[model samples]
Target: MAVETGAGARAGMEAPALEGGAVLGSLLDLKADALGTYLRARQRHGDVVRIHVGPPGLRMDMYCVFSAEGAQQVLASESANYRKDNPFYEEIRESFGNGLLTAQDADYLRQRRLVQPLFTRRRVDGYAGAVAEETAGTLASWARARDAIVDVSDEMMHLALRAVSRILFGADADATTDVVHRCFPVITEYVLRRGYSPLNVPRTWPTPGNRRAAAAAEELYGVCDRIIAERRAGGDPAEDLLTLLAGAQSPDGEGFDTAELRDQVLIFLLAGHETTATSLAFTLHLLGRHPEEQARAREEVVRVLGDRTPEAADLDRLPYLTRVLKEAMRLYPAAPVFGRNAVAAGEIDGYAVPAGATVVLAPWVTHRHPRYWSDPDRFDPGRFTPEAEASRPRYAWFPFGGGPRACIGQHFSMLESVIALAMLLRAYEIEAVDTEVPLSAGMTLRAEGPMRCRIRPVRR
Candidate 1:
């Protein structure tokens, strides 16, 4: 069935047709660089073009609406039509069960509300001291190997994972980091591979990647389960996110059972660390590429903190650092593209999209959309400056997305990035690698290889 266009003013843009098997094959063939291909196709075909990537007779509309109004509608006003429907979460559900990220509608809302206060302004602020101390300790370790060709991406991941573990679990958990690290690649690889493929395979089937992902997930869950069991046995209250959740009661007078608690804990541990780590790694890579930007960021940090550790209060004062991080995220959002399945027929920017259609809204595409931005490809932190920001409309720059389902960890991530960057800049001068490594977006947008940079200690 061809997509019926022109419900309103927008007409003549016909949806692409494909036989089901062929569509699935094409999706399976999509590489890590597939998003670039999608963006190019959208540039030629228009924002609301349709494509068939599932079994024959099953078609979906893919929207690359980069305009502020279009983004606002898809993410905010008309958002009810769109629900989280993607292979990523499907795989996650297969592995982690229905935790916060995998829960839908009422269950999702309930869990979000229960977890919301933990990420509140006051609560996130309390992590500042831990963030600073943890970051400083990581930097001290890194300084020992200043001249080593450090895989900064891996290093940042370690630092972020450790920091989040300390804040959330109140233990270093270094023994588990190796297992966690080993498991992460399996999950990430499976997600990237399956995300483009439209085939639905039963979890009971033993595909190599799927098996690895499941094993990895189980290992990670085992770690979380052990911690939960220990905490339960000891029955001590600690100042950590997990502790808060352990003590929290559901809004409707229900408390999380053991399995539910384990699921939430695993979700937070993985989601909390991976996304922020990727963002910080990319931010550092960008700074290395742009020396002037790094210098400006360092100057701002020094001016704000002046030899003192960064408190949460100092986050507002570090404008340039914020701008730099924002720009990096604009260029490379952690979760570059997200998909939604429209449960009801709706009109998005005059295009008639029917129910059961999968719609994709990509920050990768939107942030680089030529219509809404000036020199969209350029790494200009100024776009986030007060003057430039005032000129742009809301949803024009949404690395954290828009509307109610936006990243709940936005504040927490921002604060963490600021502290990490501030501490790093205070200790070392970072320079880019010899060649410019391009980005590949899987679960997160990361450099294809290790991002090697020269780091020299900065004498006070």
Candidate 2:
């Protein structure tokens, strides 16, 4: 075979390129509407597109892959060639510490081995009682606001934070719930701004944004550290996630140190609540908008639970409701876009991908790909039916990502979300007050405006 290397391979690269010439090509569009920009790029440029951003000397290449096959390749098949060494991940590592989410190589392997046991189906299912208790509290609050508008986004955020905090810290949850709720928005917004910026002032600088974020980080980290210290002092053992995490030890007696524990706790606090909150809030919003689906889901909940509080075991029983949540995830994935850096030269869809370039995978786009979905934009829970799902590619709906580095909290997230949704639907009938929700792509997906819904007590 004839050789094609270097300039020859570069010239024959088959990917379509979108050039955003000079200082900031597509940067503004990305900042303003990341989801829209990515969707449009996919629609116009097909599954594989080479996007050019930044100015002359500092120009950057993003090999954007929107196909399900491409997602599987990058996230699973050829994962070794695509590592999480990109600027976005670097920012996350800097802010969150090298927890399981950002840990690489041997560090990731060790952490996963130790932490994997805590997130197994049986272990995570045990947290169902905590989820139900928190949901009941939220239901009580919603009952008080009967016939009034509630910001579903904020409400779900609070509900999820309380549930996860209680599970993670047990008695110490109260100390951090309000602090995390107050500080996360500021911290996440700061991360999004800095993570996407072509250039940034040092976080150590006393700029207003830097100072605000630093203060938030300090307060957040202090509370977690204090709690972890107290737990390590051989105090009364609480049956919480932290207790389990601290108790986790390897065959050689290795375990997470105090600092490592803090990093893991921080990542859990971020991923555990934030993603589930988004799922719950968006599911409610979608259900509220589509009353027929809402009625159907509620009907399923009633059929299955019959005025009883939902448990983890009930997750599979509530099939229709589960589908509703899945549909919501399809429309508004919590983590819309994630990136991986090419460790070496590769080809996606026959287009040459240069080493060191970032490959972006966006569930927000892939979920709606014309090839995979019949009515891409419409909200339909039936799409998740077992047979329907079987008809599509495996990577067509990867809300939690894929492969060895996939989210460890996947089952926990589902258990929490399904239980909470069952309870919420059983307790109240909600109608979306704000029909349209504008989104801001942050470290996670967020509603740019209030996702308000009017709720009335369900008449038995």
Candidate 3:
């Protein structure tokens, strides 16, 4: 695979290289399960371990940090030294283009600056109504069911997609949503596979994988183009996020063309929705598994919100629900592992990291680090209480990550998730259809397959 650092306050000790099981080469291990491979290496070699990947000259060694200290050094303390064109991002660019999630250097800065205002407090607060509306719509659909043993994972994705669409482009996107519902999975599947593939297959190569990836990307972009075209053809749909983004002018004074607009729309639809959906799905999954916690969360919902949908102001009133969401993210972070490649020499925990080394920052591992969390594997929302949170390092729980480049939509995601959770818990009693919920890693962590749940309506 293509090759890959951070800093310190030293160059003497080389970071320990991961050995043993990885002796068969990193490809074999990664082919098994990339996250597992990294976890095993970290377990064997400590917080920072270097693993060599790929075949022959194409092989590269990447330094992965699975500790809070390393996260601080690489993400916060010396963040400027690592740019956006990290190894994982290189794979992301093909699908996302130069959008905020994939842009680098000046491009990334410019994009972040332009998009930051869109997620301002007022705008995010205004979107709460839309989030609640979508959640209500989902409940209505479930009510129409005879038995209602619905796939919560799919429902979460659908609901999130609808809410984000309403926010971005206004309502009534039947055609566009259908295409995305069909094609988004194909794009993600190919992206994850190629992102971890040992073979250096170029996107231009007409191999089966490349063809499938390209086709999916094309259809998804096609859906975006259709949305823009419909909006342009039908005149204004009041003033919304899409209108603002479309009218936004670059530094040189030129507005984004159709292609640039498509990129932004794709990134928002892809990154914004999927992560939120996964977070909500896993939150519900966990709540369903632990009935006691679910009951507590629902109690808070009932106490704060009698029977009406949750409002933006009501979010603060239910602190236990917030803790439940925070704990869920800590246990199963939506965007688990994202990497940053060093643009300059840096040191982490006294270990020297050269320029171009990819440093993996995994929230999944760090959030569960024994050093920072007690009973790391346990699902205890009490751990997120005000006193408990204050006792730990700020970076110890980074479901939204740390530093300047942390998610711009953190507020949006939290509000949407909190609203959805409250509404769902208020309406029904949920239980996992499967005794053990399996896990899988994509761009974000997700349930292995469709996570089906039994929804029993609560008596009024």
lDDT of 1 by residue, 406-439 (tens): 8888898999999999989877788878447777
Residue lDDT tens for model 2, 259-369:
999999999999999899999999999999899999999898999999787888898798999899999999999999999999998788667888898899999999999
Q: What is the TM-score of each candidate against the true structure?
A: 0.91, 0.96, 0.93
Name the regions of candidate 1 deviating beyond 4 angstroms: 1-8, 11-29, 54-64, 146-148
The C-alpha lDDT values of all candidates are: 0.76, 0.89, 0.81
Ranking by TM-score: 2, 3, 1
User: Backbone clash tally for model 1?
Assistant: 2
lDDT of 2: 0.89
Q: Show pairs that collide, candidate 2.
A: none
For 289-366, candidate 3 gives per-residue lDDT tens digits of 899999999988998899777888877898999999999899889988888888887777778788888888888888
TM-score of 1: 0.91
TM-score of 3: 0.93
Sorted by lDDT, highest first, which candidate order results?
2, 3, 1
Candidate 2 lDDT for residue 33: 81
Our tally of clashes for model 3 stands at 5
